[model samples]
Target: MVSIAQGTFRTVLLTPEGRLLDCRASSVLLPSHDGMIGILRNHAPMLCELQKGIIQVKNIPDRKNAYYLIDGGFARISLNHLTILAYEVITFEGMDREQAERTAALAKESVATKGSFVSNFDEEIDPDRAAFIVKLAHLSEIGND
Candidate 1:
């Protein structure tokens, strides 16, 4: 028999739409408004507003490290607990390949029309959110049929 160095902790990622993810993990990295934040075993209490970006989980005894692209929202971490309340989340694993590809294609076409996407431009829309969508679109392009 073998004893693991650490016990796995539970992690639940939810959105108003539904439960995006729920599982256990040893650590998680979240992209917050300020920057990337890391959560690990017995982490101190924290509450943060999230930005459009990715959430990464690492080393769940029974689960794999998970990656999710999330829209702006909020997150909380306390003791060994971590919860993310996002308005929208696109988990790489949960996405339908075809749908993802279509989304990417659409965004790409829009950017192509604009020349470079104007990542620094500010409009009625949040540029950060648009950039995040672009990133997801790019990922979808990887082996994207």
Candidate 2:
């Protein structure tokens, strides 16, 4: 339960520094510019641009969602082949729970702080991702204490 139904498909996620994910999945759910798009076996081939959001994958059966923060990118699906080439991609697996909590706390604090200290900050953070991190910390699952 750790891969697709044995098909020849590839999803490539590229980050600014390097490639993040280049693997095969049973199904790939991506956050498109308009909304989310689901790709399955023999999906129609097409190319599209994506926005900042999560890319959920159902690689292993009955497994939890695999989340990734993508800044922006283009998605190309051709004849059952899918490729997600992005400029920046951050995987939840690579995230440090302690660091996430610290950053989340800092972000919450910065929201109340007024001054040039908050000059450069992301205006809107994804609530889903935030909630996931909070839940992960609460569950102490990713070595969060």
Candidate 3:
């Protein structure tokens, strides 16, 4: 039988803009087109299309857990490395408290009043994604203050 060992692997998140994250994570949860896919060390190599949802990276050294909201793209897992290429990614990673709060508030207002979120004037608004943004903001503790 094939064996899966317990260990850490390199995880990277990228977008058309640039690379957003590179770290060692014990586990990762990806939003696949069909459903959620969990990854650990020594996983079988594969590639899959992604959907609009959150990517959770867990157990990184010297840092708390991380989360990224992706619009849609693809993911590749091979040689103990997980790389995600998304069309768009949103997170509070580098935002200051003020910016985070403002983003959180805007997301909340958009969901409550407009029933959808629009990131760009040309882009279509998605109510479901807006709701997910609110959840992401809450998880980031953006409005807990």
Candidate 4:
């Protein structure tokens, strides 16, 4: 039986550039290739392919919850640790209010214009991806200002 102390787990998100997050989270939602997968502490070990979607990390201690927009990659869960390796991951975690607002505006404009938008990272954001970024920004409450 899972103990109450086991309610949280280690979550790490990495991209080819570097590690983006390493924290303790009460829950995590990943976008698997087939569908969405919810994970908690003491989850059975497994590895799965990821798709382009938002990854939500909730109930982080002493930190605001985090949301990541990732391109396709993979996830590994074991021993109370969840690791996500993605080709690209975007989040507003370290951004100032102005940067976050700018990013959200770009995403909204891209979606409305139906044209590809280039991000600060020089990555191209298509309408579908821009829409997802907008959704993530809203969920993270980073661009709400």
In terms of lDDT, which candidate is strongest? 4
What is the C-alpha lDDT profile of model 3 across 1-145, one tens digit per residue?
6457577999999898899999999899999999999999999999999999999899898998898988899999999999999976888888787877776777778778866654532354566677777778887777976
TM-score of 3: 0.87
The prediction achieving the highest TM-score against the true structure is 4
Listed in order, each prediction's TM-score against the native is 0.69, 0.63, 0.87, 0.92
How would you encode candidate 1's per-residue C-alpha lDDT over 23-62 as one tens digit per residue?
Answer: 8888788888999988777776889998878787788676
Compute the lDDT for candidate 2: 0.62
lDDT of each: 0.67, 0.62, 0.84, 0.90
Where does candidate 3 have its weakest 10-residue lDDT segment?
116-125
User: Could you give the candidate ranking by lDDT, starting with the highest?
Assistant: 4, 3, 1, 2
lDDT of 4 at 76: 98
Q: In each prediction, how many residue pairs overlap at the backbone (N, C-alpha, C within less than 3 A)?
A: 0, 1, 0, 0
Instruction: Write down the RMSD of candidate 2 (Cα, Å).
Output: 6.0
Candidate 1 global lDDT? 0.67
- Per-residue lDDT over 1-145 for candidate 4, one digit per residue giving the tens place of the 0 to 100 score: 8575467999999898999999999999999999999998889999999999999999999988899999899999999999999987888788787878888999999999999988876799899999998999899885676
- In model 4, pairs of residues that clash are none
Evaluated against the true structure, the overall lDDT of model 4 is 0.90
